[model samples]
Every structure is written in C-alpha cells, then in structure tokens.
Target: MAVTATLTSTERQIGIAISAGLAILGLAMAAVAKTGPMALHGGMALVLGIALVFYLGGALYDHPEPTNRRHAEYYDAPTRFGIVMTLIWAVAGMGVGVWLAALMYWPEATPAVPWTSYGRLRPVHTSGVIFGFGGNALIATSFYVLQRTSRTRLADAVSPWFVLIGFNLFCLWAATGYVMGQTQSKEYAEPEWYADLWLVLVWVTYFVVYIRTLARRAEPHIYVANWYYMAFILVVAMLHIVNNLALPVTWGAGESFTIWSGVQDAMIQWWYGHNAVAFFLTAGFLGMLYYFLPVRAQRPIWSYRLSILSFWGIVFFYMWAGSHHLHYTALPYWVQTLGMTFSVMLLVPSWASAGNAIATLNGAWDKVRDDATLRFMFVAAVFYGLSTFEGSFLAIRPINSLSHFTDWTVGHVHSGTLGWVAMIVFGAIYSLVPKLWGRDDMAWPKAVEWHFWLAIAGTLIYVVSLWNAGITQGLMWRAYDEGGALSYSFIESVEAMLPYYAARTLGGGLFLAGAFLCTVNCRATMRAAGDRVDEADRPLATQPAE
Candidate 1:
C-alpha cells in the first residue's frame, strides 16, 4: 500500500469498525420497524451517526506517522464510484421520467394504482431525476473535480466511502418513500421528516469533507470549480433544512405536518422548491461543466471573468425565482412580479456561462466532431442556452397564462434535464471512466457516439412534441365565443392533445432507448474492469499548473 500524507492502519480499522456497527444498527431498525417509516429512519440515523464517528476517528488519529518517505497515491476509487454511478443513476432516473411521461397522456396509465398514481409517482420522478440521477452526477463529478482542482486526495479513506454509500442509501429511501405514499407534500421538498434528517446527516459530513480537503489544498488559488461546488454544498444544506420543516407524528414512526400554514407555507415551499433546482442542480452541474468540459477536451476556458460573472449572478438571481410557479395564485402581485423578473433576468447569467463554454471550443472543432465526450459537452452548452431561454419565456405572464399547469412546463424541464444536465453528465462519465478504470480509453468509444446520437434524437423528438402540445392545449382551453362563453369544452382541449400526446410518448420512448444504450455501454465497461488495478496504468490527472 502507498503511504498517504496521513495514512495509518489503526485509524482505518477503527473507522471500518464504526461503519460496520452503524450499518448493523440500521439493518436491525429497518427489519423491526413499526407502521410508518420514522422508526426505520431513526435506526438509519443511528447507523449514519456511528459511521460518521468512526470515519472521523480515523481522520483525526491516522496522521502520517511522521514518516520520512514521500510518495504519490493515485485516486482510483473516488473516480470509479463517481463515473459508475453517473451512468447507473442516469438510467434509473430517466426511466422514471419516461414512465411519468406516459402517465401524462393516459389517465388510466396509473389505473387507480396507489403506488403508481400521478400524485405519488410525481415525487418519485422528481426526486429520481433531481436527487438520484442529478445527485449521483453531482457527487461523482464533485469528488473528481475537488481532488483534481485542490491537488489532493479526499480528506480520508473511510470518509469518501461514507459519503458515497450514505448518499446512495439516502436516495434509495427517497425513491422508495415516494412510491410508498410517504411525503411531506411540499413541492420538491416532499421527502418526510426522517428523510430530511437523513439528508442533514449526509450533507453535513459532505460539507465537512469538502472543507477538510480544501484546507489541505496544494494549489495557489482555489479553483473556480471548487468555489462553485462549495457554494452549492453550503446553500443546498441551508435550503433543504429550511424547506423540510415538518413536525413529526412521533419519535417512533408516523406521519408529519409542516409548521408553515396557508399562504405562508405556499411561499416558503416554492422558495425551497425552485431553489433546489438552482443550487442543487444548476450550481453543482455548472461546477462539473467548468472543470470537466475544458479539462477533458484539453482546452482552457473562454473567460474566467465571464464565469465569475455568471456564477455570482446565478446565485443572487435564482433564489427568488421559485415564486414564479405561484403566479396568479395566492401570492401577492409584487411577489409574482419579482419572481418573474428574476427568472427573466436569470437568462443573462445563464447565457453568459453557456457562451463561455461554447467559446472554449474555439480551436477544438475537430475534437468536437470526433470525440463523443466533447460532443456531449458541446451539445450540453447549446441545450443550456436553449433551456434558459425557454425558461425565461415561460415565466413571462402572457406565456404563463397559456402554459401554466400544461405539458409545456414538463417539456421545458426535460430540455434542461435531458438536454443540458444529462448531456454534461454523460460527457463527465465518458471522461471519468478511463481516468478511474485505469485504461487508456473507453472500452468502446463508438458506443458512446452511438449513445450521443440516440440521446439527441430522442431529446429533440421529446422537446419538440411537447412544445407543440403545450401551445395547442393552452390555446384550446382558453377558446372563447364573442359573448365571452367557452367555445371548447375541457374534453375538447383533451381531444386536441391526442396526436401531440402520442408524439410526446414516442419522443420519450426514444430517450429511454438511448438511456438503455448507456446502461449497456457502462455495464460492459465495468465487467472489463477486474478486482484490482495496476497503479502504473493510472491516467494523468494531477499535473503542475499551466
């Protein structure tokens, strides 16, 4: 084993023991749980808490033992988890989204099934995409980015594993909870009190690990990537806690109720709901795009100043835009106006980053053409620009009047999710796999190009169909006679949407096909990777500053 700056065997053993202990407690609690999920959750907390204690025990006592030898320890494990999970969660999350898409056009698609109903499955789809798929992408890339940018391995051995395993466990509970009809009923803040507590435990440790790693950085300036990542970590922790404010039914196990009531609750919920996208999805992914896109393609960023301008601008503007969802409802006019204004203004900052990314490909046109990874990043920038513009357009009062509560909103989201976020994640995984797996290149480069085409074609079909469907549905609903009476019945509006609905289904089906391709591509790659690695084959990740 190579000597880390602070590696020690005793510390590792203690950490491992603690993790094992907590895991045992969680299993026991889950196995013996009562009715609701809360009992099972406290049991989970016990496990997480003990694991944390053990991990920290190692980090604190496992100092490098005053050894005189200095050596490099390649970070193969971190990247492996990161890359593998990006693909795994992508398939799972996107699968949920496509299923939800089918449910939209077919009311009986759920067939009164409690677990599969729209109300329940909505959270499943949202969390799967946001937390499961997006969350995995964030953790995987953040680990890779922080290590490279800080010029250090993660702060400790057990801690990184704890972060990954603990986070995935949280995701599993979230998806399962949504299906089992357990939710706080707060939009984007649906996970119940226990899930909230679980996230708190996970997020706090994530922030600590981040800080500890940064504290021991070997670089002159903390890379902008790390700054974006840290901001995301800090803000999301605060946002998640504030929004998940529910009074639990009991310490044992049961339902919970929100402290906020009526309009006050509405305001608070949307504030948390929308910002989840801003900080959790946008900020973290932007960090990935900033570091991985350029680094993978062997190009420098277009403009550092532009990046800072956009990053700060997004941070300030996006916090208030969530209320736009509440337009023309219980929210005050000024609140709606402020929400709409900020969302519209969000366009500038969003475009700035998009522009900066696209410009970075200045001399790398050949790479963009030949490299599947670069293609993923390049198209991601394009979609980022498209999604931002569409978002701003949808937030406008005239457009919201038509598209609010329609399939248009869904279409707009997928533009961001499938087009922008998923594409970038695909690029990151392609770049990270070889780096992590200790191979010279992808197990099959051509398959990645195939994955890219499948995703793009599917996305175009999906987004375009919904755009058409949303406008048609919106106009049909508001059709009026000269006497200001309804010209079209609600069912008529539904009827007009049939062809579009079928098209949307087709488009979503195509997206799923591409995702399935990715799953196969990733599985084959993993199988090729045996149990152990040859350290000499590691990629050039940490290099001297240019």
Candidate 2:
C-alpha cells in the first residue's frame, strides 16, 4: 500500500513538502559538488526525493482522505516498508560479506578496480549489515513495540517515514561512499562529515517520535523493551557524535580528519566501537528479544526485577569495557585493567538478560521444538550467553595476549553478530512477518525450518573454523624453538589459514542462503496476505489526537 493512502490530506501535503525540501537539498549538493562521489550521491538523493514527491503528490489527489479512525489503528505502513528495506540490506550486505570471505583465501578473485579491493568493500559489508540490515530491524520493531506497549499510535505519520527513509539514505550514502573511496577511515563510523550531520538529524527525529508516542501512551508503566530501545537510540547518538568529531577539508567534499590523535584516538575509536557493539548490537536486540521471544512463546518475562537489573548492569558496566580492546598497547595499564574488570562484570547482566529470555520459555519447550520461529529465538539466547562469556574471557590480559590480533577476535565478533544478533533478528522477522501481513502463518512454513538449520550450521561452521584459525595463528606467532628463536615463519601461519578461510567462506555462504530464503519467505507471505487481521490490533485511545 502507498504510504499516502493512509495519510490525511494534511499529512500528504507535509510529506510532499518534505520530499520537495529533500530534492532541493540534494540538488544544491549536486550543484556544489559538480563531480565526484558527493555529486553522484547527491544525484541519487535527488532521484529518491523526486520519486517520493511524485508518489505522494500522485496519491494526494487520487486517494480519499483518511478518517479519524486512523488514529484508532496502529501506524504500520512504515513498519512494513522498514521490513522490506531490512531484507534488501540483508541480501546486499551479507552478499558482500560472503564475497569478502571468499576473497580471503581466493585473493585472485578480487577485481582490479579500487572499489572492489578488500579495504573498500570490507566497510561496505560491515556498514551494510550493521547499519542497513540491523539498524532497519531495530527501527521497524521499535515502532511496532512502541505502539503495542504504549497502547497508542505513532505521534505523527510523517516523522516515522522521515526516520526510516532518511536512515536508509544514510546507509546508502555510507555503502556507496565506501565504494567511491570516501571515508574518514574510522571503524564503524566510516562515513564522513556530511553523512554524520545527516544522521544527527535523522536520529533526533527518531528520538522525538519515540518520546512523543510515549507521552500519548495509555499504559502507566513503561515496558522493559522500551528501556533497551531508548538506550540504543540515546547512547548511539552520543557515540556517533563523539567518535565522528572531525573537521572536513571542504563542505562539499566527502573527506575529513578526526579530531583525536595517537593513543587518544585509539581510545576514542574503541570506546565508540565496543559500545556500538554494546548498545547498537546488544541493547537494541535485547529489546527485540524481550518483546518477540516471549510473545512467540506466549509467556510473560520470567523476572521483571531481573530485567531492570540487567538493563542497569549493561548500561553501567559496558562503558568502561572498551579499553580491553587496547590491552598491552600504549594505553595506560590501569585503563586496560579497568576495561577488563568491567567486561567481566558485564557478564552478570548479559547473562541475566539472556537467561531471562530463556527462562521466559519455562513451559514452552514443546513450542520451541515444533516451531522454527521460537527455536530461532531459543538458539539466539544460548549464543548470547556463550558469546558474552567468551567476550569476558578474551578481555582478560593474559587471554588477550593469545587472542589479540588473531582471527579468534573475528570469530568472537561473528559469534555475537551472527549467532546472537542475526539469530534474534531472523526470529523476530519470522514472528512478525505473518502477523503484520494478516497471515495465520508463513506462505512456506517449511522454508522457515530450512532457514533455521542452514543458519545454525552456517554459524557453527563459520565461528568454529575461525576459532581454530585464530588459535593456530596465535600459537604459531608465539612459537619458539629449543634455541629460543621463532619456530615458524609468518608465511606458514598465513598458509595454515587457507583451509579455515575456505571453511568460513562456505559457512558464510550457507548463512547468506538462509537469509535469502528468509527474504523470499517474507515476500511470499506479504503477497499472500491471508485474511486474519486481529481486530484488537490498534491504539487504545478513544479520541482523535496526535
């Protein structure tokens, strides 16, 4: 359905005006940049804005004005659109990731072009998956959770679109800019000054929409899911603005330099990087798990106090844990110790959240056994527990010595991302897709079962291969002969990785296939649109107001 079909004439006009303003902004940027990635990006934005303006404008006169009853129903068109974008990014991002994984052992496959080089495409895979795929899931689910928990509709029709569409534009800019060699060279925060500024606008609007909706909520007590979602938004904004504190060489150019230097720069980067893991990857999805897992199992959260405890624990402990990444470096020893200590402390809350999720399924084992959707969630909780424990262990100074700079670190990250984050997302997508489209179940229920197994096998293969590869690299690098000389050449370690690299590539391919299957399943489900709309699916508010 067209977004404008649900909007009142006033809302449609607002959308058109916003679209026009965006077109003007893009045109201005294109005119100023004239040539280069910035110009091309501006042109893309111009096309997008023009298309939206035409879409909204075309519907403005053609569609009947929406009634006050819209205020009674939950705003869902934006959620539907966000889900579509989420799948698109899942394919694009994971496809690039599988390609990068293959390129590791098959270096000859990399194209001679600058953009296809490992350096450029690496961030494309990272940002594309993290921001594009993961971020969209968070936003879409947050909108859905916010309305249901609050018992109110979104504050306005327009802001949700602005947030989702604007955020996707930022993702597009990040990926395309990386391909065009426009980056600040910061990990995770790669997009340069203009994109950073654009995100600030988008993020603030998201926060405002969230707050406004809560203000109109009929529920007296805020849900725990919102707590995590709120943390995700607020902390990410703080992290983004701080880590991306850079001065651009020129207003129109997509080049810039960060403000921090030396050890301070390293400290700042990881502070943002690790916390991006904590808040962006962990917290937002905990919110997802909190909502979707229990709902799928038909259970209340096992422990409310435990939920609050874990939230505060994560919030307090994670901030100090980033320095562990800098252990044995030029960073102060005490700082590294502090980070390690906090990381260890983090396990209590991390496990609390994970355990809380699992415990919620106290009587739902049968459901988990029979339903692929619930199984996706149950497995996610297990991985979440295991990965967080491994993280704490790896943060220890002695352990970091062995694991640091190894593929073990890579394995750990994917364990959390693929095993925990992606699992929960797929679970949520499975659970949400059928409901959102008024379906009793997925169009291909068996496809979901296939996806679950593929994902599990893929994660195990990818993570376990990397684990062996990292340990081998670490052991070989530190090995000594009887003469106290290095026993193995670095090339030998590189050669040893060939088999593991191939294994991981295959693993990643399997995961990608499952994700692709999921996308297809969702497409089919949406198209089917089974006739089973829940009459109760709406705002509880009786009067019409934003």
Candidate 3:
C-alpha cells in the first residue's frame, strides 16, 4: 500500500478559506452583473473558484510526491505552470493576430459578427500577446530567476500560487471582456476598472513576494538580473496605477472615465503605452537575457559594470522617450524635441545591452552552432539591437513624419516582438522545459531547428513586406502633380496594401505554425522519461550559485 501525501493542516485551512472566499465573491458578482459580458465573466470566475476548491481540497486528501524528489530544492512548479501558460497564450494570441492580418485583406470574411470583428479582436490579439503571453513568461521566469539568483526558496508557497492564479484571472477577464465590448478604451490598459483593481492586488503581492525572497538571499551581492526584474515590477506598478486612474460610473457598472483630458490625456496615454513596451516588454525580457544567454553559453557576462551602466541608462532614458509618440501633434514642440532627443540617446544603452549578450557568446561559437536554443538567444540579441536602432531613427521628427500612421511602424513593432521578444522567450522555454522535467534535452531537438527556420522566414516576410508597403504609402501620399495637388487618393494607398497584407498574413501563419510546433514539442518533452535528479534540481541549501 502506498502512503498518501497531503497538505499540512495550515495549508489546507488557507486553501479552503481562499477557495470559499472566491466562490462567494464570484457568486455575488454574478448576481449583481446586469450586462451579458459582465455576467459571463462572473460565471467564469465562479467556475474557477469552484475548481480551485476541488483542486485544493483533493490535495489535502491525497497528493502524489513528484517522481524526481531528489532535486527538491527549487520551487519549480509555478515556473512550469507559467511555461505552459506562455505557450498556450502564444498560440491563441498569435492565432488572433494572424486572423486580424487576414481581415485586413478580406474584411468581409467575418462581416457582421461584432465578436469576431477586427475592431474588438484587435485588443484581444494585442492584450493577449502583450499581457497574456509575454506577461506570463515574465512572471514565470522571474520567479525562477529570483530563486536561483537569490539562492533562496520563494518567500512563501501560497503567495506564488496566488500571484500566478490571480494574474491569470485578470488576463482572462481582460480577454473575455474585450470580446464582450467591455473596455476602458485605454490602449494596453483596456481592461475595465474591476480587472485593473484585481491586477493591483496581484502585482502588490508579487512585489512583496519578490522583496521577501531577496531579503532571504544566501548570496552577499544581488545578481544584476534582479535589478532589471525589480525595475520591471516597480515601474510597471507605478505606470499601471498612474495611467489607469479612472472613475467607474458605479460599482456595478463596467465603464469608467479617465481623469486626464485633452493634451494631458494624450500625453499620459502615450507615456503609458511607450513604457508598457519598455518595462513590461523590454526590462523583464532583458533580465531573462542577462541570465540565460550566458548560462547556456557557459560564459561569464563580458562586463558586469557595463551591464549595470546600461541598466540604469535604459531605465532613465526610456521614461522620456514616450513623448516621441506625440510628434507632429498639437503638443508643444519643446516636449516633442525632448522626446526625440532622449529616444536618440536611448540607442546607447539599448545597444550596449544587446552587444553585451552577443559578446558573451564570443568564444562560444561552437555552442551557437551545436545548440539551436543558444542560436535563438543570439538572434534575439541581434534583433534587439536592430529594432532599437529602428526605433531611434523613427523617433526623429523628420522620419516620424514619414513613418507615422504607416505600416512601417507596425513592421518595427513586429521586428521587436516577433524577432526580439518572442524569440528569446522561446529559447528560454526550450532551455527550461527539459530541466524542469528532469530530462537532458527536448523530446524532439530537431524540431527546435524547424521552429527556428519557420520563425525566421515568417518574420522576414512580415517585416520586409510592411517596410516596403509603409515606405510606398508614405511616398505616394506625399507625392504631388506639377500643380501641387495630391498625386494619389487614399483608396489608392489602401489598394496598394493588398499584396503586402497577403504576405503579412502568410508570414503570421508561419509564425503561428512555429508556435504550434513548440507547443507539441514541449508537451512531448514533459512526458518523456528522465526521473534521475540532477545538480540543477537540488534544494537551494545544497545548490548555491557559484
């Protein structure tokens, strides 16, 4: 007879209380919701609440110890959950993105369905990828990085789970609410007041958990990665709170009015929008790069001091560059110049960080050739450099005049997102999954090569097509006949985009295909047999960082 493992009495009590509280809250929200979307989201919360009860309750009755218990030093369960969530959302988000691309060419495909319309689904794709996929990856990897770099267990068992579950709940609410036409109308901050509040709670808890863990660090000096991660958390909290300042019509109502108006509102929104790209997208992932790239390459970072300089440099400069988004607007010219200047200056730190990552792989050329995962990271660093350079150029008032409202901007964003952000994330996932599963490598290593080629080809096709499209659109719009009259109608520009849109859609399809392959490969890797515990899995006390 096998012994049944169970949670302690304290753990069981806490689990039950949280479950019960969520259940009651869900039911209350469901009852109070007068709108269809609100009610549907309430029902989802209720179902999740009930599911948690069963899951926690069952764990108290019977729990199976992990098969590879010998390496019980790190808290890897949450990271694993995060990795799975990242891949799942990657597929869903990119799937929507691909659909949106298709709709650009064939708006008649979905016709009258409000839910499937491009207008609403655009937020779904953006929020889904930015928050759902990238956000989850950040949180998950942050936890792993914090523990290993800090050389301590997570601050508390329950808090990690709470942050993960609560954060995902917020994402779910945001996605579903968007589809149901419940939004606050803020780009990247579109989730309604309720969801925003929920995120606050989760984010605060994440910060507390992180700080507490750092306090318990076994190492004397905090690693450089933690600095970037800390900045990401703190800065995001500050940005989220400030930009989302709004007054809900009522406690029961879904709508809210932002406090800032006119020029102030535009300034605030772009400030938040640009920084969302900075902290949420860039900082957290840079932390991942600082740690994973070197570790996988088996090389020390080329310059610790340079990394420190670049980190602060980025944090300071990025804050001011948001105003570049307001160029050629009614905003004051001085502020516009300020934004453009800082944006140009930002190229230094951005390239420094990228160069540092690439430089770390200097003597590891053999690994880059042999390890597809490392190659992915290497390519990500290159793209980071390339995208940052493009961003700097685009921020110049002269260039912004041409690029603004053009597909060129879209191409630049995808260059960073598809080329830099998602690539590094995929590399991290591939590096992490096998380690977490107690395996030596992925179940299908060759498939990583396949995924890489597909991603590269897709990104190139998408970016190049949009670049040409945007430049052509800009030139055509600016062109004039000898009489100085407009040379082309807006419809002409729109018609010219047809071929490019088709190519972009094809590109997105390929990227989505790569993500799907990643999912399948990860699933197989997790299921593969490799129960032997290794040094990486040993407890924190036994496995201290060198």
TM-score list, all predictions:
0.89, 0.99, 0.96
Screening candidate 3 with a backbone cut-off below 3 angstroms (N, C-alpha, C), the clashing residue pairs are 73-539
Q: Give one digit per residue, the lDDT tens place, for model 2 in 246-277.
A: 98888777888899999999999999999999
In terms of lDDT, the best-performing candidate is 2
The C-alpha local distance difference test score for the whole of candidate 1 amounts to 0.77
Write down the TM-score for model 1: 0.89
Total clashing pairs for each candidate: 0, 0, 1
lDDT of 3 by residue, 229-300 (tens): 999999999999999999988767677899999999999998999999999999999999998998899899
Task: Give the candidate number with the greatest TM-score.
Answer: 2
Candidates arranged by lDDT, highest first = 2, 3, 1
lDDT of 3 at 386: 97
Indicate the residue-level lDDT of 182 in model 3. Answer: 85
**What are the per-residue Cα lDDT tens digits for candidate 1 across 297-346?**
79889999899999899999998898898889988999999999999999
